[model samples]
Target: MMSSPPAASPQALLRRLLSGVARVFVVPVSADGQLLLHRHESDRHCYWTYPTMQRGTMRTDPATVARRLLREELGAESGVLRLVHVLPAARTHARSAVYAASLDLPAAEILAAREATGTSRRALQGLAVTAETLVALDVRPLAINDLMTTGGIPARTLLALPDLADPASTVNQPG
Candidate 1:
């Protein structure tokens, strides 16, 4: 008689669950309360997105991924990053965690760093804009619209805006 296949191990199940589900996106806030956005060198549209990457089988947490992304893409660091939303995969193989992080550096500085670190394979142009500007732009990647309509962005993010208008304000200063 043929025997039934053994059940999958717990670790194996966890790995399968994590395989394509460990991606993250961030909304990087500048000192002026502007949102950091990226535009591909070959594309004409712009949209807000944090550094994102596949977790693969590394088993790292979302916050850790966000921190690594900040370091790799913007050459900056923050003491705290707040989770805003978790966007499940719509038609893709990966789900995404969204966070809100404040950067103490200038937009130009962050863009310069990104440009210096980015290779042809990941060529991107970084820009910072206020909420009004973001609304005016023809943003792409489609997920951004979902983030807005689905109430993914926390209210705290909007509360932080007024303080950004003042350059000397210490509202989002990193600890």
Candidate 2:
């Protein structure tokens, strides 16, 4: 059999494949000013991450990735998600899409949905912290403005927060 093409040098391979890598982060914010965070059992008591999505080549579709992340981590779907920002991840070429969804939905409803769908309820075990607690917890603050300037967010789309008020009632009440 003919031999495969000669192996490419690490630099050459990296140069050729550099255009394909990216990182997407989702940030959820509640109207009460509490920030939704994911707490891993690792050394860091808590940090911010959207969901467990493939980091490299698997991150091809941003919208699909965003929708999947909300469902997997927050147990909520995209019908009411608010796009907040898209920011770059430090110095890496990767970027992140930040989103904010209110905790208007009752915890009980959230629980029932997760159970009924056979989804992992343990993903968001961390306590939802207000903006103040986030500082104390040493978690990095992600902002809507930062994501907009990094070329991470879609240029044509203006990220806006949805008025997720209950349709049944004119007044927005706690769900």
Candidate 3:
């Protein structure tokens, strides 16, 4: 029998567990509660997604992650953030906490902030368009991979069957 390699040390195991297990999604919304999605391009396809950042040294503080994402991505100070949903791994992503940030600033101001931070490359949507329009435009990005992967449907227009299980949840489910 071959000898087994050394087992992973507790420190290494803990490190692995702590790392790559958490990420945060910041969904900046207008005062009227419209989702502000940014353009995201992946190998699979281009889709709209909320600004996301990995959980850093402050592993337990998701709020910190949200604030940092807002500052870095939009170059704005923290807004009134409230937890909206917790999504387990969808596709290769780790667990994610979704926070809705209520921003009082105008879309032009937000765009300026992104430009000021030298992040003009990012395509931030103006407030006039709602998530409805994005979905209607036949663009469903990777964030909803778990659902799309299951049905092999890439867009809302193709999804015709309604789930009787939770009719309430299906209202906006592009899955």
* Best by the lDDT measure: 3
lDDT of 2 at 89: 52
Candidate 3 regions with alpha-carbon error over 4 angstroms: 1-21, 31-34, 41-46, 56-60, 119-121, 130-132, 137-175
As for candidate 2, its clashing pairs are: 86-147
The 10-residue segment with the lowest total lDDT in model 2:
152-161
RMSD (Å) of each candidate, 1 decimal? 10.1, 12.8, 11.1
Give the better candidate number (1 or 3) by lDDT: 3
Top-TM-score structure, candidate number: 1
* Residue runs of model 2 more than 4 Å from their true location after superposition: 1-21, 29-34, 42-60, 91-93, 102-104, 115-118, 126-128, 140-175
Across residues 106-151, which tens digit of lDDT does each residue of candidate 3 receive? 6677776677778646787753343344445533334543332333
Q: What lDDT does candidate 3 reach at residue 17?
A: 38
Question: lDDT tens digits, residues 51-157, model 1?
Answer: 57676577686678888877776667864466555566777435766666777776777667766766223544444444454455655545643444323232234
Q: Counting only residues 3 or more apart in sequence or on different chains, how many pairs clash (N, Cα, C under 3 Å) in candidate 2?
A: 1
lDDT winner between candidates 1 and 2: 1
The stretch of ten residues in a row with the least summed lDDT in candidate 3 is: 157-166
**Can you write out model 2's per-residue Cα lDDT over 1-175, one digit (the tens) per residue?**
9989999775564334333436555555443333445555567564544443444567365445666776786677543454344455565335554544445554456556776886775555334443344434544433432332333221212233332222132323232
